[model samples]
Target: MSFLGLAHCSLPPQAESLRQEVREFLAGALAGRGAAARAQSWDGFDPEFSRSIGARGWIGMTWPRRYGGAERSALERYVVIEEMLAAGAPVSAHWFGDRQTGPLLLRYGTEAQRVSILPAIARGELFFCIGMSEPDAGSDVAAIRSRARRVPGGWELSGAKVWTTNAHRAHSMLGLFRTAPEAAERHAGLSQFLVDMRSPGVSVRPITDMAGREHFNEVRLDQVFVPDSALVGTEGDGWAQVMAELAYERSGPERYLSGVQLLLELVRAAGPAAGERARVAVGRAVASMVTLRQMSLAIAGMLEAGANPAQEAAIVKDLGTAFEQSLPEVVHELLGVEPDRAADTDLGRVHAVLLELAPCFSLRGGTREVLRGIIARGLGLR
Candidate 1:
């Protein structure tokens, strides 16, 4: 009946109210806000939308008050995100920073670093991206060769980060680099730094995805100077820090929301109560979504309890990506409308974009192979 001894979860009473509030906010706030684009989420950057969310105290909804955060419950934050993704808002501008980097910084960053960075992030004034993946090291995060040499007041970094989402427009990036030469242990001798996007030695080149969206980029770091205060946590402890951060990144509503809009559209097309086959398909899809969302929420509870469920998070991400990527095919079966843009111009745009973007779902956060390997090792099967 159970796999990992993890208990089933139910949302608290507050969660339902928060979800309703977010729904109303999105209904009036995001309606008719922007229509030229079609679900350009994740990498769909929008500063105005981010600022509006920040003004409503939703950016860092669950962080400390000193950093301009509302300090609400994690469940509340999850509800807000659920509503945002449902409304197809362009939250990619402040998504990475708010979701992973800011929280990580609040936990591990030094006093000066937090004082300077956290408030701006909470206000949605400063956007950030992660510099993890390199040219050859896709899933092997430990194989990164970005070098950061010790200098007078800080470190001098030199290297590049590939597939960096929003790097071209970000205000800063938290890049993992080698402080010392590579050691026998891949996790050793590595460090992380806050690299300013406006620094003299930095360069950002946009990489358009197959969907024709200029949302990804290659960020080059050439002798970029970062002050010693920019370091988060201990120097050699970055490998551990990054692993902990991935626990936050990999376990979230975003993993499942990638194709949810398409699913809802399909359901709309199928009518109130479709035939037996269509009804079964829709029920199966919704059940899968509900199950996955429960797993993600459980991880959030664990995080609130100050526990790290890294293996569990990796599992959710891998399975969730597989689940999200299946909506298009199932929709095609239940509804005869294909992804052909010209087939139905009324809503073909949404279907076409979802199909164009489905392949990348398994690639982002972490590849499916890497996630499965992590799960295998956790179960002592590797």
Candidate 2:
């Protein structure tokens, strides 16, 4: 029952229409003055770009209309995400909120929490980061040691989160902290809290990725106070809640397109000499990407049907990350460019950045090994 068995859902015509709309919007993005510049749009952050996405009613497109969303099918939002990643628009500003946290909140958050958070997220006025992986727990989310003791009106949180993407700029973090000792129940005592990054006891320091981007951060919480209502779902549903969240995280187009721009660049640069090898490589890559899209959309359709696509999502992530991570080497071989997209003013710079950032593809949502274990368990192999 992993991925809620979304290995089976279908797409409708409106998905293509959404893709066209996104295509047109991105085309006009460069025509305007002071157009936002970005090195890598997915990881790149631009408040204005995020707001524009919101203005189009594209952000949270699958959510209910009462919260400023279009109430569209999840398949439509899938198209929007596909186009956004292909265009490399600066979506990191609202990435987590639009991609995962909003959906997670809609499912598990209290009504008050939904009303307060969903609209702002839809408005693209706020940003969110994950506070799941700790220094010791990295991929072992069940091993998270960030403890939150019950206080008068709320919880007192004291713990550290590492590799929190965009924590320096996020308005809040969907933080995972322990409410009871692991000695009681490994997963029982866990809880999720909406921690204000600007709170008095919260400290955030940026971590620079190899691409010279300050996207990741180390977040320290020292007795930060979060109200009871800030808690998402029940007191001890963090593990289940987060498992659902990762499905949203890994099944998106972002997983497949992390290296797509470079792939597109390679295709263009291939020029008159796209030869059999280059043609085969690009064609294979595109086919894999398309299949990934179809799989992801199927999962989205399942979500629309109120099913959790965790297993479907795990397969998509493992495959998509491989496609994205392989683009650098594939493009380099096809284009005969030097391995150095890290340097500005060179065609290789983008490819180089993709190479440097490739290792993180599997690490972000969940480790590859963790995802495979879930898959194996789903297949009754474990």
Candidate 3:
């Protein structure tokens, strides 16, 4: 409960060694890809690349061995992910499954669910998307209208989810649905279900972003039937479950590293002859990344120790996203290069795409205002 007590964190000796291995792997795997490709970062989807990483037993590095995991520590997994992001590896194909869904399944899913799904995720043969936000819900989890009604052997789910990343390509979704009528407690009556995207009556339609990319999707469920085995954890416990999952989603390197290529591009564009302002700006950006990394690492350490660091995760996400969103603007000002989407240079392509995508960094994980509220409530300030 002490917000002032920042947990001390340092990579273990094994983690230090593992970093070199990951870097070497990235070098060979990412050979011809330039900064523009790296700028896509975790959002870049390459199933073949994901399968290659999985072949190395890097996908489920921290899960239990029985579930096809490597049984490594979270710190080890942290090093792998940091290296992947830093090198701008195309990790999106298996990123969500590795980052949160697999962990959540291990924690709250049935044993049968774990045995069936975790191994595929580790093998990079299956992908998962979260089903939290609805057309009406956005960040307000309590406002979701997607509901499930009992139907003998299982339940019938009917409603839609928006902003579902990779839904078109995902094999399954950990969907949140209302199981009962709204009660006096708004967070009550919510439930989580393991939805098979390929099931009858389920549909996925891509939603193109301003950048003309189709990473997000609108998933519609019209009386989709799921067996009882699909229910996750106890009934009406999804609110708590979703909150825990957010900690995993929001505290990672992706929160801050979205615009890393832009910073690198800035340095490349403003060579040694650049003015003092450019140097100072680059230094300041680097410092911010360092600070956020420390905070995120602290949270990762806590998670490794079986501790709930939701509050700390919120703090990292809020500040990390602010840093990410502002980086492109800072780069534009300091480098003074007009971003051209059609430009032949790596920096130009990266700059143009980042300028369009930067605004989403804050909106994607959790809005700045929502995250700040979570942090305040955790610190007893609300």
Candidate 4:
């Protein structure tokens, strides 16, 4: 088996120009935002901020114009996302819709679904949450026990989903349910649906994190009925469709930029009088970030070329999340500062928040073990 290599990819001049526009917009929008708030990273939810982003035509930039996209290049979209993440903007409101759901719909949804959903998502009016993990199954998506039974008009779903981010606030959920009995193949008999959050018998319970935030949720569905039109792609093909979606989830700059607020704080705390060791540690962290960005950009290029770089995306997410998870510890060691959320200094507060949030960096998109397994299988080393 041949090993995969991430080719160097450069952003176009247009993409850089778009970057400047995003920067200018964020400068005014994110003014007065403290480091503690910024430390929330993409987990920060602000619907108004998201709507403003939509008005700027920054969301769903790569989809066709008919679906409220600008029909811009993927690289342009990448630039916008990079800037948003780097600025530590509150983007969770539209993050799932713009990052994966819109693209998933464009690929697998019916024309009606696209017409009804994509425009709202592009306008940042409709928010979505993913329902894949179960109480028992986390990163092992195939082991999910959520079930959907055939009904007169559509399907009746009855199951529970855990760690569903923003489910309480989302208008809809892209849920994966088992439609048939378990077969010899573990991934068979699954289907995807766009379930309305307001449907009868659907309940959401927020899961507070170590940081005392409530972005994560546990969703329960008791025979929640969904119309036939809500079915995404062919029945029983959810495994393949979900795999494609994971490529989008794992290939973005969010994987690496989660702890950036802490990094910025470290730089502020370590002034020009910083010692050589501090400089070296900061330099190493920056170098890792740059390399991961290059790899992520390569995945975007492959995506633009109509290729599924699932393995490449897995590699980037694995490495990128590792970098993010390590940053808080590195900063603590370098600055010799104890993490205290109530501290008066920006660095202390940022560091404290990141210490709480960093543990989830690898657990969210895909666990470290799961990502490494993907990379190993891709390299034929398994």
C-alpha TM-score for every candidate: 0.95, 0.93, 0.97, 0.98
Ranking by TM-score: 4, 3, 1, 2
lDDT of each: 0.82, 0.82, 0.89, 0.90
Kindly report which residue stretches of model 4 are placed more than 4 angstroms away from their true locations once superposed.
Answer: none
What's model 3's overall lDDT?
0.89
TM-score, predicted candidate 4 vs. hidden true structure? 0.98
Candidate 1 C-alpha lDDT tens digits along 106-153: 889987888888888889899998999999778888889899999999
Pick the TM-score winner: 4
lDDT of 4 by residue, 1-382 (tens): 4435567799999899888999999999999988888888677899999999998888898989999999999889999998988888999999999998999999999999999999999998999999999988887789888999999999999999999999999999999999988889989999999999999999999999876788889999999999899899999999999988888999998889888888888888888888998899999998998899999999888888888888888888988988998988898777786778899989889888888888888888888999999988987888
For candidate 3, lDDT tens digit of each residue in 99-130?
Answer: 98999999998899999999999998898898
Q: How many steric clashes does model 4 contain?
A: 0
Off by over 4 Å in 2: 1-10, 31-39, 335-337, 342-346
**TM-score result, candidate 3:** 0.97
Cα lDDT of candidate 4 equals 0.90
RMSD of 2: 2.6
- Model 1 RMSD in Å is 2.0
Q: What lDDT does candidate 2 reach at residue 291?
A: 84
- Number of clashing residue pairs in every model? 0, 7, 0, 0
Model 2, residue pairs in steric clash: 3-308, 3-309, 3-310, 3-311, 341-348, 341-349, 341-352
